[model samples]
Target: MYKISICVISFVFLFFLSVSLFTFSMNFLLNELTYFIEWEVVTLNSSSIVMTFLFDWISLMFMSFVLLISSLVIYYSKEYMAEDYNINRFIMLVLMFIMSMMLLIISPNLISILLGWDGLGLVSYCLVIYFQNVKSYNAGMLTALSNRIGDVALLLAIAWMLNYGGWNFIFYLELMKNDFDMMVIGALVMLAAMTKSAQIPFSSWLPAAMAAPTPVSALVHSSTLVTAGVYLLIRFNCLLENTWLGQFLLLFSGLTMFMAGLGANYEFDLKKIIALSTLSQLGLMMSILSMGFYKLAFFHLLTHALFKALLFMCAGAIIHNMKNSQDIRNMGNLVLQMPLTASCLNLANLALCGMPFLAGFYSKDLILEIVSLSYLNMFSFFLYFFSTGLTVCYSLRLVYYLMTGDFNSSSFMPLNDEGFVMLKGMMGLVIMAIIGGSILSWLIFPVPDMICLPSELKLLTLFVCLLGGISGYLISNVSLMFENKALNYYSMSNFIGTMWFLPIISTLGVINYPLKSGMMILKSFDQGWSEYFGGQMLYNSLKMNSSYNQLFQNNNLKIYLMSFIFWLIILTSLLII
Candidate 1:
């Protein structure tokens, strides 16, 4: 059973081989083992809709990493869900999510992508609501409905691509330069990617989605669901590089990063804070990709996956031991209790803060160096560095709260790391979270990017790290709201805390007024003028005509005699004429 849970031996072998293959294919055409296999699913008119898979190093490596993360999460879930009556159902849902993500990763065809995309959305909805509680139900609805926008956008892009006689977007992505139809398609695809990645207005669903089981959060937030959009946009880099939309996405994603970091500081829920961190990193990847540093984005994406998965695994272990209480305020100085899990959690947070020699440092530091060298306005520059600091701030704050203070929960309740099975699962990711950054930096880029900046500029990243660490450490231990006096300035604090009310504006603002207006429309139009004039007039006229027409067909004696006399007179008149 344990072997079955850690079912990634083949992928683990391929994971290492990907480095060789990527270098070989990238540097020399002679060693090119790239494969493109297509099956004609159906043909309509002059258009051929085919299911296509491209086996390049990128797809294989990403697929392997995804499977690897999922397997660990599954292994973790084995111990976590051991007592659940329907444990088999949970594993199957996770497997289905993995299969859907595999389809999404390998398929270059838009129609097939949509299939995988919709599968992800549907399966994720089920996973989010696995607890079958009201909170989970609401979260599942938000997750499903939010992803539906992306699904519809992808569908529209696929339909429009039919005019070009191919749903394989990879072929069109390069030729999309200034072509109006292709540009429209590109815009639609971008919108789909944005929604899937949870940028700005679509961001609320991500934190809500944490209502899912922790293992699901580990799998989804780490390597599969959220990364799908980033992966798609990376594949569509050709179109984005040439379009103004890239700049647009840069602005949106920057704000998203800043917003998420801010929200994490204000949040108390353990999983929600981590979820916001994921959002912030996602924004980082998207923003860098927008700036035409796709390789850099991919680098960060891979590294972030490593540490973030480990982080969630540790969080899960803690939550389980805490009897499923996820409020950080309920937890304090947990290091005195669950030392192993605390160590792992602290390592994950440090990596997230881009601490030196960790998995996050290689990718995150490179991203920052490149951004500083690029021609960015002061606003973007401020956003990038400030958001980076906020990441450290929240990460350190979380660490301090968990590692330093007195135990806030019941002292009698035993807290210990006795779950070796869970620890074994985390150990795999923990090793990666330590060394994965350096390994990926070496693998993905055979010829690494060169960055040379002045002393002050180079030190800026370090400076921000120091400053954020200081602030996070200095923060009052009474949680942000009470210590910061947020209750006194309630409205301002609430506004910032709730992601600038984008949730309310996006969910409630979208739902309430329109629904109220729709009710009014129903009353005024359906029950009033249209109903009276259209239905009543038509009904009366039809009823009267039907009454006259019914006499001829009623089989009544008088009606029969009248019809016979009328026909007889008509025949006689015709003969006389």
Candidate 2:
């Protein structure tokens, strides 16, 4: 009830904001409007810190979408978390997360955004560990620690901005676009965004965070948390255009997309597969931003949120009915038992694959077309096309296993869409996923993005779709036994299947050796030679000194006389010398 009321308030607020902005855009053309509420200023140093908010098409539209999705997710949670004892606490944490995201969306200042940045990290850690299990605990730790990297990076960026004489770094982006100091700031911000966005070395945490509740997963993976990095880059896009670090982002983001898409095809866990898909989409966003298409990247970001949240909700329904079993191998012919869920799932999957007329098709197809027109080198070309194809391939593969096979669950298990609250939550998103892309495409871009290419190049997307579909069908239904066996083999399968051992590398490879070395050092130095020389050696010397002092104090005349004679002999020898 509290959730529903809060969501309503948020939805109405964003609704009026959208309407007002749309009306304003019709009368006058404003590039940007910034408002600052002064918080403090140091008189002696002439420095000031203020709460600055930037309202533009990007922030308003993005905020509307965030609020819409969050509202739906909260409504969906009513039934999903009905049995939990701490439902109020859960709702509070979620609302706090939404507030953080709101702060992030509005603010343009480096120091101000940190408030939202740290808020996201801390709240997400709480959400990940909501279950209080070992897996959840571990996932929470990884999520918090990985995001800590971004926090530290942001702090460094704030420090770097001090040299520019102010904390409102957003104001300086254009003035210092090509300067060395701005370049350094851009690099640090990019690094921070990558950690928050889970790029490369930080990629393992996003998947691990699936240990969280499904609603949290839907929100975090879809909009609020993971997109922080992409949004950060979008804000800094002006500074990054044509820079060497932009080229590096293009290369690595492409790799991340490819890696995640490949990893998705090999994953069997239902939520994990979706999480990896989210990673792939993030890579796509980052890569496009690197290529200087900030608007296009943001367009895709909004549309992806709609469909991806629906996809996760539908998945949540299936998981709830399936007795919490998330393995796709254990699920089959679910469409017959749960028709509405299957329909929603199919729609979401189609949108993900860029099916014509769906939400993903408008933004995704345009992105690919634009990428095609760009003057990319051979490697970049391969990465772009292949990653796009991989999206279709894994999506088709998922549908085949879950929708086509015979029912594999126990006879006593009844699967049905009894979770109406969940389905109700999905309804609005379903409509959006079907038409949101087309509508946003019409509303957002004043002029259609230009794509000049050969006929063959223009049809590349269709060709890849055909190839990926065929490949997916063959692998899912008619692949050779030997091929399947090879995939299950220990060495070959493990490398590709476990995401090139990134999980192991991020965890064991990172910590194991360093921890072992520390233990060895503690034993060899702190406990061995240092202890013997500092503690035991000092104690023995102190005892010997005390014993010699007692001997000198002995009340024996013979001892005293012997000592005196020794001193006299020493004096005679010195005199002779």
Estimate, for each residue in 255-374, the C-alpha lDDT of model 2 and write its tens digit: 999999988877889999999999999999999999899989999999999999999999999999998999998898998999999999999999999999999999989998988888
lDDT value for model 2: 0.87
Candidate 1 error regions (>4 Å):
1-32, 40-49, 477-488, 522-577
Scanning candidate 1 in windows of ten residues, the lowest lDDT window is 2-11
Please provide TM-scores, in order, for all candidate models, with all chains considered together. 0.86, 0.89
**Tens-digit per-residue lDDT, 1-577, candidate 1:** 5433333443344345545544444443334467889888788997766678987767877876787787678777778888777877787788789889889988988978998999999999999999999999999999999899999999999899888888877787676656888878878988999889999989999999999999999989989999999999898887777469888899999999999998888888999999999999999999999998888898898889999999999999999998999988889888989999999999999999999999999998999999999988898899899999999999998987787778888878689999997999999889999999887777676587778899999999999989988877765444554654665656655877799898887788889998999999999899989999999889999999998888667879998888899999999999999
Clashes by residue pair, model 2: none
**Residue ranges of candidate 2 with Cα displaced over 4 Å:** 1-49, 478-489, 532-577
